[model samples]
Target: MLKQYSFEKTAVQSFDAQTTLALKTEDLQVFYGANHAMHDANLGFPKNQITALIGASGSGKSTYLRSLNRMNDGIATVTGKIWYHGVNINEPNVNIYEIRKHIGMVFQRPNPFSKSIRENIVYALKANGMKSKADLDERVETSLRGAALWDEVKDTLDKSALSLSGGQQQRLCIARSIAMAPDVLLLDEPCSALDPISTVKVEETLLELQKQYTIIIVTHNMQQAARVSSQCAFFHLGHVMEYTSTGTMFSNPQIPVTQDYIAGSFG
Candidate 1:
């Protein structure tokens, strides 16, 4: 049996007063049937910046991330306010599909459709009623470029997406997401399955994209979080143990549990 340690909740540090919040959660909680998977998760994601949620397995970091975009709608019971654009998206009457159009998500594994690279990027646009050939063409190029894949696939647009390597396919999926022009991007362990070289590419792509999109990523990789995120939140047993700037969290963790986890004493 694993030992359970109780930790005092540390106040989540606020961003600069001049910083604009892209999204924020208030008293968020998640449950799977009867299992309370997350506690009151109050955190804000700064506009056009990257925030990394880090923790060991089953610590509820992913659960909190999923709630941001209501990805837990069908699988879990999520209660609280997810605020975006001055609206509480957690309301029962809120249109989830509409909310998703503004907040896109990428999963742990790369899941590209069994279509051509061009089709994979254009599919969502078409389904959303985009019909102009010129507009679609421009969007395809920009989205792919945004994902750092246009240079390699420009000459092979008609090739099957499955024909690409795992990393490329993941980038293609990101292209698909960005083609929707979402303001916020949520990534869940996107690089966990990739080789180191591929991981670097994805990280670079993220750094570039943050110029236009607020990003929230759930990752177990401490080094990757340090490299890509401006802020970091540590979760422990369904609660936020500490949330602060990435540099501060790593260099001088105020919470002993955070220090222990960062030091590899325990997770």
Candidate 2:
């Protein structure tokens, strides 16, 4: 039988005014039809840092992550404030397209286009009216370098993105997202499909990327959370049971639910 955990005991960290946040959620709740998928999720993501959402399957980590940049639109009802740059982006009148430009997302699996590597990087930019060859070329290089894929593919820009290895393709997807110069990047299990070596590459890329973009990642791997994130949030059955430093979360979880989940005794 599945163990039941109390929602009463919780620990979510709050940043002070001195610490700048790239995004903040207040009383964020998500519902799919009658099913409450996520409860009141309030958390702050510090600028240029990485935050990992760790939880078991169906715990609503992905649901909450999707709602951050309005990826849940038409799929689920997400209510409450998603504050970005002092604006409540959760408002119905807010421009989701603009919001997404600032807050980008990469999926669980690598989904690269059938086009060439260069084309994949420039597709959105061209659609947005960047017609200059020189500018497009520069963006392609800058973004690929940002994702740490430039050296490997610099000479093969015209090659098909799908022709690259799984890890390369995923990094390309990340490069595509960063090409927009988003202030925040959201990744859902970015390394799950990767092999150990590939996973390390992606993790290294994330560590470097945190110097410029605030990153929020949802991963089932606790070790990945400990390796990459400064702050960790533990989700259980739609509730954020604990939020604290990664070291503390792994070594000293405050709540029973969090401790059990981290110890692999539950979840």
Candidate 3:
């Protein structure tokens, strides 16, 4: 049997309109050899709301996050149905490129390729089949402005992306992700590595972006989750101990596990 998270060949499950959800995992069970990283997980993610997946370090936050875009496809084996709109993305008939086009992701670390700042964002537009130079320039500017980094790097469009500070690089990454004009954004702890100012910029950028695209964030920072998310889902040992509004999850937790987790009892 093949295992997930091996970086071999990630498995994919694509779902489109008529699916009733921006994303859904129906009994998603993943294994890494004998270790059951994610149990029979079921979830429905709404469209256009900031949904935060908060949990301890190895609770499958990033695993589930990658599963959303079939970023797990590189692993040799994976089983389960992940519906996007209404179709199973794991099915072979669906278009992976098209599915990924609608779903964009940012990693825990800001991984920008060795390219000019302008080239980074433009590259995504080009991949999406935008060829006109004027159109490309407009999107590049727009995305950078949207990420709240345009004014800082606008004058250095041709500068190397590697030259920017950590926060700026992260914002650049966000710019590149949104340049694709995706309907949804998946962030895997995008602020864990940033300074306070940089983190604030990313959070602000998310606020600006979510008005148009549904956002799903996997964050360990309780404050970050508490401050930015409208809804919260707490996972523990592959189980969702609690799922509710931020207010309820924080102030009026319905589950003892949720209350303990919120109080920093056990991971």
Please name the candidate that would achieve the greatest TM-score relative to the true structure. Answer: 2
C-alpha lDDT of all candidate models, in order: 0.92, 0.95, 0.81
lDDT of candidate 2 vs native? 0.95
Q: Would you estimate the TM-scores of all the predictions? A: 0.97, 0.98, 0.89
Position 34, candidate 3: lDDT? 72
Candidate 2 structure quality by residue, lDDT tens digits, 138-161: 999999999999999999999999
Q: Give the total clashing residue pairs for model 3.
A: 22
Off by over 4 Å in 3: 1-20
The candidate scoring highest on lDDT is 2
User: Superposing all C-alpha atoms, what RMSD in Å does each candidate have to the true structure?
Assistant: 1.2, 0.8, 6.6
**Cα lDDT of model 1 by residue, 19-112, tens digit:** 8999989999999999999998889899999999998899999888888888898899999888899999998899988999899999899999
In model 1, what is the error at residue 110, expressed in angstroms?
A: 0.2
Candidate 1: lDDT of 250? 94
- In terms of lDDT, the poorest run of 10 residues in model 2 is 1-10
Reference-based lDDT, residue 97, model 3: 80
Question: Model 3, range 1-267, lDDT digits (tens) per residue?
Answer: 211222222212233455445778887877777777776566777677788999888888788878778788766245789977678887767787888888999999999989999999988778768999999999999999989999999889999999999999999998998899898899999999999988998999898887888899999999999988977888776666566777778898766666677898766
Count of steric clashes across candidates, in order: 0, 0, 22
Error of 3 at 204 (Å): 1.0
In angstroms, the error of model 1 at 75 is 1.0
